[model samples]
Target: MADPTSLLPQPNREEDPETPSNNLHHSLDQIIEQSEASFGWNQFLQSILVSLASLFDGTQTFISVYTDATPTWHCTSGTTTCNSSSDICDLSTSDWAWDSISSKTIISDWNLQCSSSFITGLPASSYFMGGVIGGLLLGTLADSSLGRKRLLVISCITMSVAAFATIFSTNVWIYSALRFVSGIGRSCISTCVLVLLMERVGRKWRPRVGIMQFFFFTLGFLSLPAIAYINRANSWRALYLCTSIPAMLYCFLLQFFVKESPRWLFMNGRGEEAIAILKKSALSNPNSEFNSVLLSADLLSQVPESTKSIDPYKSMKDLFAKKWAMKRTLIVMVLGFGIGMVYYGMPLGVGNLGFNIYLSVMFNALLEIPSYPLTLIILEKWSRKLSVLWFCLVSGICGVVCAVVGDKQKVIRIVLELASFFCSRTAWNLISMFTVELFPTCVRNSATSLLRQSYILSAVFSSMLVSVGSSNGFLSYGVFGVAIFVSGFFVAFLPDTRGGTLCDTMDEQERKESMILG
Candidate 1:
């Protein structure tokens, strides 16, 4: 493998006693020219599109399985087949039985579906736990080692392979293990897809790009129900196999087309390669006036002098040192945690509320589409703090109303559900954008990844809460409402990043502070 550091930009230098000091200036001129010839709008869009492919991979892997029947409540026929004509055996619905059946069915629809003789709900919960672990581990990997493009490609390949492997599991244990692996890949892909988009796109375009990311994600989400509805008659294994097809295609497309982020390259100190990439990018743009020397000079000027001596680890430590950093981190962390609880909790809670599970999830996901536009409008016209605060408050209040209305009042339930969906979706969109802005670029990925992990970690707790709340009426929704309401208070602490330039280094922050004080 190429040296990772080689991807970053380096300053120009000359080595010889005869060389004048001006020789360094001449070299800087050439570097700037090269950098200018490299950047273009097409390169930016293409890189983002490729990175976003992982989002589709995640959606496919996540929603393939659905609840059908319970193990203890099985129909007595000694025969396990649910769809005899399709030769698909009905797997046990007991927590263990469900996983084993889903796993085996995904592997291949055989005549006899395996039963979970010893498996239980604990194993079922393990699948989710595995997802949490996967999101954190892979998310960190994406930030630390694998550049976004490589990480995304790898995630799709592994997720596809794991999804396919799920079809062949012999028992619940194997099935659960495979799902866990798939979850890890899915989490990594999802997190990186967002991180990569935000990092690569221009500051002015981040919100719109984020909207596009989720828009495509919603496209995947919409496709899932249709796939499920169409394949409902087939064995469950067929669903896993079918969804894996897109990921395989994405893997092929990414290998040949995707480019790494220039910003990431610069940060890593691969000035030469970063310049090379910019040259390629500029050439790709028909409208661009390509000037390699000018680009090189510009880049050289921007390159920090002491970067060679700087420690990446120390950069991270500085993120929490000041009141502003500490305050932003705490607020975003709480926002993620609360959003995770509500975002995941709502769908599960709605299902338990005796509504049409499919319609509820679909409608909730559909609501997210409008949020992108709403976000764009709010971000442009309203302050970031105000936009986030308004959305959180609305969503929280609606969630509380949803809880109080109950299932008996159909009209009231429908209205509250729709309102809750809109609020929650908007809140999450703002939170994602806000988190990206809170930290400086050097440690942005690390900080965002850690905060996001807090969200995923909170999800595990939400899952447990859902399980407990399922036994009592209105408890899950009520608890979810309370959590979201509390999250709104933290939104007040978040800074307004609207109209702010991307903070590439702490010096930028210092400069801004100085200007404000002056």
Candidate 2:
């Protein structure tokens, strides 16, 4: 076991005699690296706010399933036979008896059963495609001009407005267009929240903090079935309002509740403000001693005196400037594209299995509860590379199994789907953390945003495939199986990031592997 005392700075190590000041001479990350020990109240407070954003992300991610659901239908008394395989609405509602008392979904409300496939999948696909465009355009601002707090606030408010507008969508064209706008506006929420949450704590607490955010996200996903079930027979507008109202309220609460990160502030040369925040943190956790003067001096040495002059695009450009950095990003992006198909496709395709759609969605969401805790365990004790690789391979097999299970055996098919969901969730959760660690603090947001965009881009194509292949098991899960397994094989080429300190700058990240080897 490592010595507990080594975590703290030792007075005897080397005293740099003060010429005119008495202060610890280390960088901002160095100070946290040496001094941070426990998960403090300040970090906990920040996490509550960040995890709330994750809840919103989870809500937005699968909200389309509810709002755009293909509604339950029945045929009128002697008009025509109720053949589900064909459009039941083709016969005018006047001839066919309307089964339901109200409009159950956009699909039913607009009589889209006879609509083209592209038109049917447009809303969800456009939302994802918009995410790809939005993340690339706005996500960089978090690492540069806007900082994490403002970006999160903006994203939440944007999603709320879009959800509100969607309640009054006049046509499919209008609804699909608004979803694209919402996707672009709220695209930075997950990436910004993840980065801001981690920056609030020391490296030792990062894995725990990350898992905690995911736990909140899983809870959000679980809430959907309950909300949707309650309004299942009612107009889909009701579900949209339920999710939107709370999200709008959360945006307002953010102003009074959230604080900007001291690390980000200091890194940008806002030393005095950073010191003020650190003092608040020091008080919040009385056990941790914070020497503000010493920390401020360290901050001054690292950040240029004039932070205002820094280029806004510097962080984005830095991502491509280094060969290793570029390679690392490209390889991980390829893997993310594969994971994306399964991650988003699983729950969306659950209803296509000819089972009870509500029950199937709930069952899939249930597995996420255990998956996140299990992810925390793997992150702490196992090789991060192996964790991702093995989980991917296992999930792939589960997907293929799901494809082979006959529709007659619904229970067996559901079991394989749940197994596939479990493995995929674990792998995706770990991949989020692994990618965060692989890059430096400076461009971490941009790098992660890029990976997220890759995932969203894949979802654009995969969403269409799953929809068109709703009745064909092999086309959906089978394709997912092959893609994930291929990504798993590439994991062998990457280095294990566990058992080492997180790098705070690109230079440190570039030197990380060589230092570990030496």
Candidate 3:
């Protein structure tokens, strides 16, 4: 086989200004410069908007306000107090009235609430349950028919619309329903973006790009508080409205800038279109020699023979055909679920622990910044299995220590929480990369999405656990510790894919096996 890199277009080295190649080179340079500039600016703006979209969910902000209000119930400090005495009640003296009021607004009337009950936590947990279902349904669609770019666009638009609709909800049921829809859209967007980015970039860039996605996701976490501060006085509805605008705008912008995945095009038998895209990509490479047929051959070679005639559903069946793959799927699923439980549970659990919810979440989010760099260093310098094992073990140990501290020593608990945060973030980063590496390209997105649904599902369970553990001191932390410990066991099942090239198809794996034996 010829070197795949050679097939890509190379820059015209002939310096004669009169030559057609040189003229094309100059034009290509201009295009390259423009594309880079546009991509950077657009990504920056989108990052901010994405952060705002998260804030629209208002999980942290709403919990904080509802928890902190001492007098009349208001969504935030800046909210206009209900001037009508009829609307505002001093139900603290009456048990029945207090229960009624607490049901509607627990944060403002915390004295009447049963903190340790599951019912109190049902609203948030319901959203997560919706997220799980959404993830499974939409995630598969994202892997099969929609393609990553289209899935993201559609998810974002629907999420934005659902978010805005949440504002008009009069009761918890309506709010939960809208949140469920939004959760599904959010799950699809998150997974699709990962799939899209990994497919577009070269193998060498995969880990770095994977880390970059989480970095931006963490930025969304960091910015959530600030956005909440700005819209604190406004109705919670305003937050949704704010998030919707950016999502809708981005959907429009994506139509112009985002290209369909060439890999997907080829897999779907749209070979001509895929070839055209490759030609355009080659043309954009100022250092590449233009060769359309050569580029097409290289791209075509990446498509496995099995994939050529296989239906999408059949492709999924093959993913689990081998024992190693089945093991990989199970391990990834369990690990994702455990991590999701810890990650989502911590924020909501901490909120109920009577800490400053915003500050706690921000602190946790900040801890994630170091995770990507640490993962990069470990994956490059150490083994994937070792890195995952170390992170999960250490995180579980920290969780245990935190549980032992019992929130009695505020400073100690905070320090332990931060340490645990770091470990969880690192574990999650490794899991995402590891899962991506475990499957062939044909079923890569599908397998990863299915595995990730476990995470979303666990998130729902964790949220409910938060409501249950709210009143019991040390219960939530204790359970979280156990979850982290179990995650470490699951990590043992994953095969190390460190220092390996991304497998473009199952045929690549077969070839590797044959080469090893020969």
The CA lDDT of each predicted structure is: 0.59, 0.76, 0.60
How big is the positional error of residue 289 in model 3, measured in Å on the Cα after superposition? 4.4
Against the true structure, what is each candidate's TM-score? 0.77, 0.91, 0.78
In order of TM-score, best first, we have: 2, 3, 1
lDDT of 1: 0.59
Write one digit per residue (lDDT tens) for candidate 2, span 1-518. Answer: 33222344543323321111112223455455433446666768778877897787787778877777676665555544545554554566654444564477788788786777688889999889888998988888887888878888998888878988988998899999888988886788888877777776766788888887788778788899999989877888888788888988999778678988766776676767766776666665555656543433434554535345678768888888998888888878888888887888878888778888889888888889998778888888999898899989988998888888888888888888888778888888888888887887678888888888888887887777778767688888888877887887777777777755556567666555664565
Worst 10 residues of 2 by lDDT: 16-25
RMSD (CA, Å), candidate 2 to true, equals 4.8
Q: Comparing 2 and 3 by lDDT, which wins?
A: 2
Deviation in Å, model 2, residue 277 alpha carbon: 2.0
Ranking by lDDT: 2, 3, 1
Pairs that clash in candidate 3: 9-288, 9-289, 10-287, 10-288, 10-289, 11-287, 11-288, 66-107
**Runs of candidate 2 exceeding 4 Å displacement:** 1-26, 34-36, 78-80, 83-98, 292-301, 306-308
User: Residue 439: error of model 2 in Å?
Assistant: 0.8
Q: What is residue 357's positional error in candidate 1, in angstroms? A: 2.8
The candidate with the higher TM-score, 1 or 3, is: 3
Clashes of 3: 8
True-structure lDDT of candidate 3: 0.60
Q: Write the per-residue lDDT of candidate 1 for residues 1-518, one digit (tens) a residue.
A: 23222333442333222112233322332232333334466646674566457456535533622422221212334454542222224334331233233323332232223333123222234545665676555554443456566777877787778877877776556776776777666655655666666665555556766566666766776677677667656666677777877677778877777766556566556666656665665576454443534333444554534343454345445667766767777788788777766776666555456566567767776777787788788877787777766766776777677777755786676567677767776777777777777666666666676666666666666656665665563566666667777877787766566755455565555555555445
